[model samples]
Every structure is written in structure tokens, then in C-alpha cells.
Target: MNYSIKVTGLKYTMTIISATELQKNRIKKLVDLLKQCENINQQIENLME
Candidate 1:
């Protein structure tokens, strides 16, 4: 999986995040999101073909 974030008007801060950290927080939720994305991708591919 990939992670990215964007924001504006933010003060300097120290932050740390990695895939392992993310999964540890909510692995089930993340897995469900990934599955949903995969299903959508497959549907789009079917339409194109």
C-alpha cells in the first residue's frame, strides 16, 4: 500500500508515519479499503475490455 498527505497553512511540526505504524493502528480497516479499491479496479478493467 501507499500513503500520502497534503495540507496548507500548517506550522512546523515533527511527525512520523510508516506502513507498519498505519497497519498497527487499524489493519482491518486498511485491508477492507484495499479490497474495495481492488473490486473497483476490476470493474473498470472489465468495462474497458
Candidate 2:
């Protein structure tokens, strides 16, 4: 079966598709990691100021 996921971030939004549940879960995990990285970077920038 095919699965679709919508990922939205501060700058943009997009749709992703996967052929299996495992692939979809992996994509979701990666997206979460990216979001965490963005938040950490923003915190660092704020600290610099």
C-alpha cells in the first residue's frame, strides 16, 4: 500500500509519499529530526545576541 505524509515547516510545506509503512515512519522521524535541528539552531542564534 501507499502512504502520504504532509510536512510543514516555518518556511514551506510539502507532501511526501512512501510505498510502505516502514518508509513512511522513517520519513516522519527524519522530518522530526530536522525540526529539532532548526529549533536548536535558532536557540544558538538567540544566545549569540
Per-candidate alpha-carbon RMSD to the true structure:
9.2, 5.3
Write down the lDDT of every candidate, Cα atoms only.
0.52, 0.61
lDDT: worst 10-residue window of model 1: 5-14
Cα lDDT tens digits, model 1, 15-42, are 3355575555585565556566666777
Q: Write the per-residue lDDT of candidate 2 for residues 1-49, one digit (tens) a residue.
A: 2223332344534366444778777877777776777778778879999
The local lDDT score (0 to 100) that residue 31 gets in candidate 1 is 50
Question: Highest TM-score, which number?
Answer: 2
Give me the overall lDDT of model 1.
0.52
Give candidate 2 regions above 4 Å deviation. 1-14
Cα deviation of 28, candidate 2, in Å: 0.3
For residue 19, what is the lDDT in candidate 2?
47
